[model samples]
Target chain A: MSPSLSWIDPGELKETLSRIGISVDGPPAPPPSFRPEPSEDQPSPPPTPNTEASPPPPHFEPVISVAERIDRFARWLEQLTHGAPMSIADPEGLLIEGRGLPEPLALASVALDRALRPIRGLLGTHQVGSVTLEIDGGRLVQTIWVVTPIGRVALGIMVERPLEPGRVELVREGLRRVFDW
Target chain B: MFGLTIASQKGGVGKTTVALNLSYAMARRGWRTLLVDTDPAGAIGLSLTKKLSQAPGLADHLYQHTPIAGLIVETKLKGLGILPTGKIPADESERFTNGLADGAVLKAIQTAAQGRYDVVVYDTPSGFVGATLGAMRASRYVVSPVQAEPIAARGVMRIFEVIGALRAKGHPVELLGILLTMLHTKTQSSLAVAEDLWKTLPGNLLFEATVPRDPAFLEASAAGVPVGLLRRRPPPIAMVFDQLAAELEARLAPDAKDVANEPIALVD
Candidate 1:
């Protein structure tokens, strides 16, 4: 409930519903995701900038070349987990390099791009920073981005089954070390 | 010419029936009309004509380079045309899912219809997903046929929410009106719900003409003809659709000439 609307009485609720032509005897329906602005007496809420509206332009034009970086990362990921298909894409979702990815995963990347905006929006709104998708029942795909000093890089890995807690930590640590974050 | 999409988020609300009959009514009134079926289920072909059920259509035009003009079939009713949703292959569905955008397809269909038809009516799929959004983007007007039941009325309200969201994003589409279908006056609950919606919903959004629950519609559909075009002297529900057509024409009459002159290029 919004702080300002906390003062609303039952009579006002009926009156409001009446003005909207909803002649309901019960209380009016609650609003979805309403957040009232802070009053003068209250301290203002922390500013949450809409980074999506004005994302910083990509900073890195890698001198090492994209193909070289992709090859290096693919080799490193192979050492971390054997026989697991993986694909690496930039923050813009263009596939940089991939190895052993199934046809469905390769083809579903476009639909997956549509999900990225909503995932970013959810991250912006909430504290959740990482997202995972379960594909083909048991197959799991976890994605996390590394914000380096130069630019953002998104890495995704697909494994045969759901990752154990220790394996998830290992994956995160591997990404952190691989990106030198 | 005005491009209208008869859409609803809920199924079995007579969207195909409305699209077919309305096209016939407009054609009978000396307007060249085209009905485009975008539903993958191909209900329009089942209801209107079965011969073209497996015919290649919109998907073919989008996936392949098949011209939209070649896909159009002349219906039994004079002055009316249909572009059926014919045989989309598995790979084509994969392409659509993999971002074969509808912008080009919408442009092709509308550009073809512009020179030949006075109105293009799109009968969309049930949910407000990819095909519905594509149709809405191409259309200037959206007229939703809402079933005269509580749950279906909620779906009608949901359509308004989607229309508002589209307009907020600067899309030029607008809601024409909500047509109440399958009304049974003898039932108190139906009459009460209709009366409630009539009084509560905002100005001029509900159509004055209501389609009664009649077996004539099913009979006409089973016989593969619009209720308005049946061989009988006058089908029982034909007058209801005629009145609806007259009202719609009157509403669209003021800008009809202006719209005919200014068809926009279908690109983002």
Candidate 2:
């Protein structure tokens, strides 16, 4: 609905689906927290410079980092969500996969809506392919994911499978840590 | 040699079938071929040789920095070599993608394959996840197989978007072609869908022969042998495979130049 000739934003759909208690299995566990101060095991990275005064590197490094992160997250999703296959509709139409997995996925789309609304004014969203999902007894139990310019994000839940509450808590916390939510 | 990564954003698209037959075809043509299975499902290993419970494949080589060629295990199939990912591809994969700054396995294999392999086929995992990207980065030419369906065509387009993004970022990887499989010609819908994709997909239109869906691929899957090796009935599918093999061979010869050499053309 947002745009013609494009794929749907799976993250938004996932949030909406989570609302009705659908869980998904594919999306990455959010990234390890980016601490302002270095963790004990690792030495501190080079100190941040004053943005106004510091010149950006001649070659862009942050862009490369994001691409690498997508790869990292994609790997996580692929490993856990081995069974189901997801696909993006033409262009950016709603992401679809494993038919009949709607109820819980619809709810996860709701949850995704809640999460992205706050960030919408700041970061634009991306359209990724169908989240891997299974239609198990008409309830969803897993998370799906998509890769974006900023990083890899979770696709909405498939109603066929609901997220396990414990794992949801863990991923929720991880999302909080990743975005400082 | 253009290192080719065969990937699918969706599974059950005959990715392994393409990989297996492609390997057999290469070997039959007297090319030194290596099929690398980055798929955790281990379909390549399962199809090519005995199921491996424990062994050093890509994950081991990537995580432990094992010498790439050292992991090569020659198969019963004469002109082929397999570098497999046994049981722990996932566990070991996390240790690398989550931890390493650079591609460990890609670097290892590419360096070892400078002259050793005339063709390297990477059987990618299903989906647009990390494994597929890693496989794509390792190979400059990507060969994708899509089920000849509307939904499947969408997957093919999405993957091209991915390939396009990578190339835009100077990844230098190029899509070789989008090959259609499971040709259900009886269905008008499927045929129409294929017709539509020819107009949508990018790059050189491959030899026009489509790989017809046949029970031989399944039987070979059951027997853990390449379809090209199966001597069976309805010889048509086998003949299709022969044509498919020749088209790929012509396209993938080490001397094969960049796709840019010819103006990029869509199927339309």
For candidate 1, lDDT tens digit of each residue in A113-168?
A: 55676776866842123456787546777555555443454556676555565665
lDDT of 2 by residue, B11-35 (tens): 5567778887878777776667888
| Candidate 1 ranges beyond 4 A from true positions | A1-181, B90-104, B258-268
DockQ of each: 0.02, 0.02
Off by over 4 Å in 2: A1-181, B52-54, B89-104, B199-203, B232-235, B252-268
lDDT of 1 by residue, B1-268 (tens): 7678898865556788899888888888777999988766566887866577678887677667788889999876677999987786422433442222243466457788886888888887655656777787778888988766544654344576666666666676777777888777766555655665665554366777787778788788767888876765867689887888888876674857443447779996
What DockQ would candidate 1 receive versus the native complex?
A: 0.02
Task: Kindly report the TM-score of the first chain in candidate 2.
Answer: 0.29
Candidates in order have lDDT scores of: 0.64, 0.56
Compared with the true structure, what per-residue lDDT tens digits does model 2 show for residues A1-181? 2221122244543443233222333432221132133359987667867899977647633322222332343344344444232222211222323211222243354355445545655656543222333444454445534343324444443333555555445434433233221
True contacts kept of each: 0.00, 0.00
> What does the i-RMS of model 2 come to?
18.5
**Residue range with the least summed lDDT across 10 consecutive positions in model 2 chain B:** B94-103
lDDT of model 1 at position B60: 76
